[model samples]
Target: MSKISDVILRGVTGAFITNSGVGKIGMPAEHSAGLQQAAASGIPLMAKLPSDKFGTFIGYSEVGIGAALLAPFVPNKIAGAALTAFTGGLLSMYFRNPENTQADGIRPTQEGMPLAKDFFMLAIGLALMTQNEK
Candidate 1:
């Protein structure tokens, strides 16, 4: 049996990520193109994919990860691993893009605030992975 707090955490985070993925599934070409470009900054291989394909791929990936987290049968460690990997990629992208950070290099500029906030999600993922099963 899962702890109430853990269940709540998974439910909230999973729903948010799933919703985000759903929104990106049919994103416009221009939007996807821009997102692809940004992603490429961290993972150069992303540049090889077409914007539309990349967008669809990302959307599906998010949905799968979110679903894993939401599914009670899925182990917390497994779901946490997925979330960690996803957030790690986002954090890499945030650090790779110069425009996202300020002169200090760690701090976020106005445009980077959204990505900066992903650190919290990263922390949540880590927490889920480390929590002892009751």
Candidate 2:
């Protein structure tokens, strides 16, 4: 990869993931309500886990992914795969719950927009993964 491309990928994607991971780890309470609500909406399995624990798990995973990507020694493909799986779970929650979206069902409602943004994460992850195949 060109130096500029390397910097853009590592800098932009790494920073984004790192910030996300920090936010998740630092603010479990803020996300608890939405987590519980999603469980209530369709993902009954989520309901079985304590909200705080679930949040912590998510936080740890994000932190790990962020760290993996930011660490120079770690392979981009591994980080990309982890990010893809994480975002896939998020998208699954959004798609599984109709109430989370607007009348059109594809567009997210006010509550769903946060979840909707995972599309970008998915795209970023896929891009990183594909780049590594060359």
Best by lDDT: 1
For each candidate in turn, give its C-alpha RMSD to the true structure in angstroms: 1.2, 3.0
Off by over 4 Å in 1: none
Candidate 1 lDDT score at position 61 = 88
TM-score for each of the candidates? 0.94, 0.74
Best by TM-score: 1
Q: Candidate 2 — what's its lDDT?
A: 0.72
Residue 123 Cα positional deviation in candidate 2, in Å, after optimal superposition: 0.8
lDDT of 2 at 6: 51
lDDT per residue as tens, model 1, 13-113: 99999998988897888889988998888889889998877787889989999999899998888888899999999999989988999998899999889
